[model samples]
Target: MRSLSLSNLLRHHKHTAFGHDDSHLPRQVIEVAIDDSEDTHELPARKRRGRAQSTAGTIKGVIRRASLSLKGMVHVHRRPSVTAEPSDLNQQLPNGRPTSAHHTWNRLRHAAPFRRSRSVYGLNGTEDGLYEQQQLDHQMPIPAMGDEPPYIPMNTGAAAKASVALQNEYYNRQAMHTQWLQSASEDSNDRESGIGIVVTEPFMESGVSDDGSMLGQDSNISRIDFIKELPSELAIHVLAYLDAAALAKASVVSRHWNEVVRNQHIWRESCLREMTTTYATSEPVQPGAGLGIPEIAPSKNWRQIYRAKAELAQKWKEGKACPMYLNGHTDSIYCLQFDEYKIVSGSRDKTIRIWDMQTLECRLVIGPPEVVNAPNVLEDAEGNPTHYVNLSDSYKAAPSKPQVASFAEHHKASILCLQYDDEIMVTGSSDSTCIVYDVRNGYRPIRRLTHHTAAVLDLAFDDKHIVTCSKDISICVWDRATGALLRQLRGHTGPVNAVQMRGNTIVSCSGDFRVKLWNIDTGRNIREFVGHTKGLACSQFSEDGRYVASAGNDKVIRIWDANTGECVREMRAHDNLVRSLHIDSVSGRLISGSYDTDIKVWDMETGRQLLYFPRWHASWVLSAKSDYRRIVSTGQDPKILIMDFGADVENIEMLKSANTGIGGIRL
Candidate 1:
């Protein structure tokens, strides 16, 4: 009965294990009694029924265990486990409980079945054991209701194949990344090497790159643009290193760069800067005038009459070509002439000044008298001195403070031209009259030839004739000996402005835009050159008499063949009117002066502009003449400028001193 009761109790507990409620009290008591009794054996009939039922339950549990084991085996076959050392899987229990041999043996037993199944299915035994051990470890904590199933291992074919494939993919990716890195490193190394070679080469010989070029090369290396991009102040400092000739060339590079290099203050600073160095060692100790003949006169000693001229020349060189300052004239200078002993200047100040040519000092200023005398019988209202008159009261006179030359007051208007022959001087006035003065005698006019209805613009004289052109469209040939009118050649329809003589032929230019060639003997117009588009200013025949150069307001300087009267060459010579033209007979060079204040030298044969003096004058260069090695230019600045083009420096220095004034020296 106890055995039967034991079997009944076990069966009841089995059903109750899965139920939520417990209703069998007898079954519980029977279970307690069987547990307390020793040797509690069952009877045949009850034992048989109990054994059948227990067998059925055990079989059902075994089938369930097999199914779970099969599932674990399949799972393990798909994915292999990684083996870890005992140290790697270490786990601390609560209260730091130490692992015992008994615990290890039990754990091994729990994983034994999985290990066996793994071996049969061609799976890794060690990996299967690890996986199964982990499963048993989790299940061990739960109380066993009937029987707990053991872990089973799986096959390893799928997991091993998957791992090999993954390893191959990883190796391929790594190889590709390494190749990319290597290529990039090579490219960087190549670039660095190229740059090093380029930087080490000399600028002139190197073919690597140029900053000035506009091609694919880097702009930082371009020579010209790099220079241009420099800061203006820095650029000015660089330009300061250049000499005058170099600076002048730099000014033509570009407009912005030109402004930086051509600044007047910069030029002045450079002049002063250079002077500081030169003055310390090379200051002129002796007067330059005493070194040679005075520039004004080849035959005179400038030292006696003009010691100041030597001092001024030294000062001019030290000052580095600064313009000379003159203070006598109140208006623009219109005419300048140098004689053997004096430098005469005429101005709109209504005065003519004679400066000591040797001394470069103003010696005399002659104008109309302060007072003039009326003719007898000319009376005032008071009639006090009707028969007598004060001659000084009839004209203007110069101041008495400075010693001045005696001059006749005759012209009622500005004097345009002056011609001197020894003691006789002839002056053409804007008043349409020519006055002949006996300069050796008292201030007296020998004759007044009134032939033109308009101003006499120019006058020329030879040994026999005095030829004059007037605004009245007439050319008057006169006897220079007696101031008598010889003949009048009248063909121009406009103002006849300039006259030139070539042997017996008198060539005249006019506002009629024509050049007329006339026979002085017959007073007949022989031929006319009629290609000028503007009024002619001046004309001159070449020294060989083969060509005639004519300049005018048209800004064109035309050279015409003398016999054919056909234009041989035309030069756009000036920005404004060509005021004067002079040819160097010995050098075959042509020098032109213009209202643009510029003087240009040209090679007549090639028609090429040789040199340009852009700012030689502050106003119109009204006249220019060159005598082989020296050029003299006069402008509205009331000063004559002398330029020497000779090999003898001593002679030039002497000439500079002799021709002294508030003007320029040629040397």
Candidate 2:
């Protein structure tokens, strides 16, 4: 028969005493120790063989002994040694062997009757509620001194309510972690297990200890740095979606996140997205043109470039400007023209002065020329002829007609209007003639054609011809090569104020309140646009010659279809008469100056005002011109106002306006 040990009987009694179930316990094996020296001699060969065959019967005998009622056996096998150290603690017994400590604790702790208490584990007062309340306190957003209010996420249409719900949910999950820690601290029995154990379920009074391992895992997750674990490539890509303002704020999150966000590609893509598209032609100089700024470069710092544009726009919008005094012209400046290099202004002082834009120095002044004849010669000591003072005098036969002092005495009266190209500059004047100067050849007068009976008001030219409008109510088409009047246009009943020509089309505005489109070669009116109630001041044909824009004393600007003469749109833009107008086809911006002392920039297509400089001119702004760098305006005030909007602003305006309509988008 199999024999059982005292320890095994004690384990059986402990299970029964605690009312613990053991129905699923594994089958037990009973071991009987025999002296090794007498094992084979004591048993017969046949008896030993039979013992080996009865191994199965021995296992069944142990199970039958365990099946006996433990209450009957406890009286026989109850051992007090289990509470102390036993010699056979490591010895194997029937079923699994129970250690001494396991037997002692099982008997002492499990045998006691279960009791419910209001508190346990030394926490009986507010201390227990304090831990729970502190965990819940995390749900409130702490007020920070200057920090922006928290960005509460919204998951529904009721943003405020949804955000509150989300905020609560977020904090509750966070509170779960703290509650888990409190539960862990309250249970002294669990900590002895080790870090490998965790409790996932949240701490609740009902059964927090049941899933303590799960709760530990949930709490430990709060310590993970999620953003820090993302790959740098993905981190940067995520940051690229943030706007400039948010990106600056995110950089302060942490050192590791900051480092990932500082990746150049992230800022590059952001800068590129915010920046307007720039074209090479919009720049003052081509890349190799040897000018102040090149159109293209091998590399670029996108951040600085974008910042410069943003700052420039900010300053312009704020009307923050440092006025530059170009102290020159003694009298009111009547007409002005400028390129990137210099500003050529005509003043009532009867002089045309060129001022270097960069140096702000008067480069040169062209005034009426003086003619001096050679003095009469006197005989020197060696019989060589010399002048009375020193040099010899010379003489040539004079012409029959009284000649003007010099050919370059360009005007007898004030220069009224001007137009120029790279090679030549043409100026019209009250002298009743238009003079063409060779700008490449010392600015000397190349041709002087007398055609108008009164002061010339405006002029435009190309390589082949120069067209001039005058107060005499006529337009003269002149041959650029020779001082010959090619054709006379005489249809206007009033003085023509402004005129512009493109290819075969000539558009002119007159005091008759009419905008006439003329064929320059034939000197005949192709069409007429009549809309202004008062006299027209300026007119221009669009570059493609499909449309014409006109503005005048009517305090209105109108755009008309060139072919059909249909009035497309009209804008009442000024409180006073508009004096001059210009259009930039590339940017689609129309600029107008008025007697109101204001200069406005407009969108020609939509007739929407984009920007306006109010009282930018101390006096009436007579004429204004704009390009990539600046807008140069000269008026009844002698001082020239150069509004430097910074380089490449035209490109920015173009990009920002490209997709807009009336009441359009703005940067």
Candidate 3:
């Protein structure tokens, strides 16, 4: 395991982190270590021995064992004891030689990977033993033949001079360390005395079994998971060399491998190096506003979390998914969304249902409150609600509030679209209104938005604004806190079927065959996209507001560049009108639902269709949304379809803990 451990440690961090081939790391000492290793590793060990030839302590026992086991080869090429280099191995060492310090470094560097393969070694060609490296070393140019200049070409003048200088520096540092050790040792006699120098004979001679058949350890050594014999800290240090995939494979070898591989140190490094997550965002990040990679919570199980991320990614790539049906809604389901705890869906059954995410049990079923009529509400000739009470201060002062119309808990009509954050849930409906529910307080009705004249087709909200599009060919922007109409946008010549918001920008698709961008605050047109040959039913604005996506009667999805108002990509796969589309900004996948009864996932960047399901919904697929784990789609079918990418991922709950919010990825 020692040689296997050393090789993994070097290959993983050295070549992988410091990148030699495609890497420009100042520490390219690696490529030299494998192909042309000669200098740095040996200089320090040789220097220490030259200074205190007789002094020994902890190193004495180690050297004795190494001498017996390795038979004499260890001294020339490998680290036999504690090593100090010019500094770095970063600064102190020259030719990359694996140091005991490098091993510790492999531990430290891997100990805490931030969000950020192996060469199998040994005679067995498994990464668990160390025999063949002895044979492989002989293949390298035989160490130096007593100072015959050098094997690396010194034919070029500049190359020769530089090599000479580096060689000189190597000797100079070694001499300095030797002198320092000599000075330090002169005063100390407490260490092992140099008098009785003990040495041992090799286990085999004249082509005998070096497997230690003579010592009876042959059975033990052959079966040992070499890592088990080392101290706990040392074992962890050794295991750190293996990547997540390798660590997982090593765990099944034996109980000991399983135990050592579970070390918090090993997985912590793996998580940091491989795990990544994003902060909770109610909506896309606004311009000049962004969240950095979220730090993993220390309370979670990182190993299971790592595994789930790995498997889920593969599942998405291969279009492998497990399906579960949510069948509570009695009529066509129009919209749905899920978070860590629950799935909240709105349906044409005039109801809202929240399903427990894990058990698929109906947690709560709510619908429009019983209302006699819309109270004290008047409409203009165009049918827009004219008289709406600003009830914030009224409700705050008088805790017992009077009914604001017998309004929507509040959708009195079929709910069309909805969005929720931690505190409240907002639903739009054919009732020409939006209702806000206090999600934290038993789903109580709080505010009502009566700004649209026609059916509210879709809605999106952020911290400040609630944006809603309507079949009235108008879009209304409202203040989230006060429920006051902020701005009414009028541009689409036909009913605005879908709307999406990212920071200050809003994207809306209309039946008029046009897609437009608008500034939520200024209420002015930013740009317009016109590539669809027919009406657009659904649209999405990228998190950065640089791209817009829309689909409708044209039976295709067009990716638009918001700045240029140009359709950049026309992704065609649907056999009928595409109804709903969403982009998972975290994964860069475009999920679309269509009347064709198909839902397809696309690589938004490449404009290539990745996964497609023919008839995922039995009828017109109305809406679809996704995160890293699953895609949630609702359609003309009474049932909602959940394509759970994590269904087969073991210990999925642990993965959810790390995925605190949407758009987080662990790879």
* Leading candidate by TM-score: 3
CA lDDT, every model vs. true structure: 0.54, 0.58, 0.62
The lDDT of model 1 is: 0.54
Query: Local error of candidate 3 at 278, Å?
Result: 8.8
Candidate with best lDDT: 3
Deviation of model 2 at 185, angstroms:
30
The residue-by-residue lDDT of candidate 3 on 273-373, one tens digit each, is 55443222344322112121223555666676566667778888999887766654668988887776567888886777666565555555576444222
Off by over 4 Å in 3: 1-266, 277-299, 369-409, 658-667
Segments of candidate 2 deviating more than 4 angstroms? 1-293, 299-307, 313-320, 369-407, 647-667
For model 3, the local distance difference test gives 0.62
Alpha-carbon shift of residue 333 in model 1 (angstroms): 1.8
Candidate rank order under TM-score = 3, 2, 1
Put down candidate 2 lDDT per residue, 1-667, tens digits, no spaces: 1123323433433354336443445525222211112223245778766755764467654443333322222321223232434464444333343534344333322221221112222111121121110111123211111112443223445544543443343344444344344333443222222212223333222121111111112333444445566777777888887767667655644456667667666766776555433321243222223222223332444445445656665755554544454544556777888766667777665566665555455555565653112121112356543211101124311111111123545677787788766678888887888778777665677778786899998888888988898999999988888868889998999999999987788999899999998888788888988778999888877656767889989899998988899999899999999998877653466789999999998887799888888987778878877654467888887677777665334333221211211111111
Model 3: lDDT of residue 69: 32
Quickly count the clashes in candidate 3: 7
TM match of model 2 to true structure: 0.52
